[model samples]
Target: MTPSLLEALHWSTMDISGAEYRGKEVPLLVVPTRYLLKLDTTMISYCDMQRVLFEEEKSAYNQAMQQNICDGKIHPLTSIHHTSTYNSLCKLMEYCLSPAVTTLQDRLKENELRLSMLQEEAKQLEADTQNMRNGSPRRLMNHGAGGKSSPTAQSRHPFSNQGSPRSPSGGSRRRAC
Candidate 1:
């Protein structure tokens, strides 16, 4: 809802709890809406009315609809079915429903769009994973008993040869104190 909408619809207040016209409860919830549409129609009614089309005047009209009515719930109207009153009310219904319908349609369209995008992304990832698996080698060694490296490679540098038989000291000679 916008202030222009309320202004276009000629709505003075948003609260409608105690609104009455000629002693009858006048449902003002739709008054602002009615006035908005009425303004739109009136502007377009005569060829020389110098009014802009709805789309052109949409911003202003929408602003009017956003007007808030605070605290004042009860209102008394002097007359019912005045030409201005009827037109304003009717416009309210048309404008309110129009945006709602558009919003619902847009949401559904966006949901469908996102669903398609996600599906495509999932398919691409799955294909990439499958390709990597197919290209990689399958054989793998477990690091248990037979598969373990020689102690020389695992513990000391191979070139150092601290325990090699080629050393000057015999392999069984214990070191002297």
Candidate 2:
């Protein structure tokens, strides 16, 4: 109160009159989280999906084996074969799940570059407007002509007859108020 930079009281300041904190017991509600999660109970799990894909792959291989009676046919149940199948499945899953993050990042970069370019243009236009609002160097130089101003662009400059009378009625100031 006396300009001493005193610290303000916080919630834990129990020494003040009737200032103790009170606890409340509120009933908790079980809010539905369905909106928070993008989950469907009907969707199969990843392991189930992989099992189904493996069954399909095996059926396709069996059909191919029936069609081709070559004795040098490679076995389908090898560990290397399973690895390649899993790798292909994972690649498919990744391709399906990817959200085009790189494309969005590229677009964001382009927009930022455009924004900076527009800001620079705005700055240049602001400077030009300021220069035009005040008297420009060209206008100032043209005002050095004698009292007889030509009826051209130079004579129409804002500072053309600045040193002459400023009023229509007969005030003697150099500039209009």
Give RMSD to native, each candidate.
Answer: 24.5, 22.8
Which of the numbered candidates is closest to the native, going by highest TM-score? 2
Assess candidate 1 and give its TM-score to the true structure. 0.26
Deviating ranges (above 4 Å) for candidate 2: 1-94, 97-99, 136-177
> What TM-scores do the predictions have?
0.26, 0.26
Q: How many clashes show up per model?
A: 25, 0
Cα lDDT tens digits, model 2, 32-137, are: 7876554333233544665677677767655655655457664555545655765686677556535444555676899999999778666755754675689876
What lDDT tens digits, residue by residue, belong to model 1 across residues 52-171? Answer: 333434554344433322353322231222335445755765575566557657878998999997786667557546655766422211221233434533343443233333324655
Q: Which portions of model 1 miss their true places by more than 4 Å?
A: 1-94, 137-177
Q: Would you list the C-alpha lDDT of every candidate in the order shown?
A: 0.48, 0.58
